[model samples]
Target: MTFPLRWLWWLPVLLLLQACSSIPTLPVAPTTTPVAGVQGMASYYGARHHGRKTASGERFNQNALTAAHRTLPFGTRVRVTNLNNQKSVVVRINDRGPYAKGRIIDLSAEAARELNMIRAGVAKVRVERLE
Candidate 1:
């Protein structure tokens, strides 16, 4: 059974609002040079995801010195240092996220190895953008 046509107009508006609500909002990153440094827990992606396409539209290479940052512009280079051991490795920002909570960056396996964090799979890191 059909009701009044006037109510039909509200359907499209409601649907559009629902759709917009579901779209995730990304944090606004600085268009200028990045700030001093970001300190947070970091994680890594490796062989299991090797060769997959990254958010930057490039193939993911676990061996490459690349990383995913939530807000850094693609191709931005940053030095990630493992706070635990003071080991650091420079990685290009090539993707989007760690997805997991409490993590700031996702590193390539090679970067993780360079930072000596593979054993723990995660580490407290200090990230400083490269000029």
Candidate 2:
């Protein structure tokens, strides 16, 4: 088999474009004020991640009322209310992402417990940003 040497230059450009496209871009926090709230599935992480560093450079504390949101700015406070149990808790955004598909937020263990959703592991909830 024979390869075309003249076409080699185009290969690098194509590869670079592909690499750029495949790199996932983190969602940017909105510059303007956000809406009052949003409703979606919420989940929690604890124990295993408790001592790890978060995207915001803080240690993850399962007992703290903290949470991860896709684009909410770090230090933003939000109230998450479980639709099923009618329980709610305030959590500070200290990380980025739920990571899991279809989930809107990831909460700390204490926040999950406060919402009475520890057993279910996930819940449908309303998240209201607090000023």
Candidate 3:
């Protein structure tokens, strides 16, 4: 049996719409300045995420003291402060972002543990870009 020509045209349109809807919308431009009082939970990934290729094309290593930022350029270093404990650690940006809304950054598992946030699975923190 032959399909109708009209159905063929509609198939392309449906496929296009599906593709567009499936893509997540990213911010047009991300803020570079430090966000104050923007506290939320922070989590880390290791082992599984390690050695994987990052958005910046660098190999991810959980022990490397690296991080992911929504907007910061790759290789940019930032100081992450744990608001709950007042502890902080410097991390190099080597990847994209937390991807979850309301989360600021994604730190290596070691980094999160350093801030004493491993138990909580999250921490309130601030991220400041450094030169």
Q: How many clashes show up per model?
A: 0, 0, 1
- How do the residues 92-129 of candidate 1 rate in per-residue lDDT, one tens digit apiece? 99999989999989999999999999999999999999
- TM-score of each prediction: 0.74, 0.75, 0.70
lDDT of 2 at 127: 94
Q: What tens digits encode model 2's per-residue C-alpha lDDT throughout 1-131?
A: 88989989999999989888866699997764457778999999999998999999999999999999988899999999999989999999999989999999999999999999999999999999998
RMSDs, each prediction? 8.6, 8.8, 9.7
The superposed Cα distance between candidate 3 and the true structure at residue 100, in angstroms, equals 1.8
Off by over 4 Å in 2: 1-34
Local distance difference test values of all predictions, in order: 0.92, 0.93, 0.83
Residue 28 alpha-carbon offset, candidate 2, angstroms: 14
TM-score comparison, 1 vs 3, better candidate: 1
Report the candidate with higher lDDT, 2 versus 3. 2
- Which of candidates 1 and 2 is the stronger one according to TM-score? 2
Candidate 3's C-alpha runs over 4 A off are 1-38
What C-alpha lDDT, on a 0 to 100 scale, does residue 63 get in candidate 3? 85
- 23-59: candidate 3 lDDT, tens digit per residue: 5787675456455445566778788898899999989
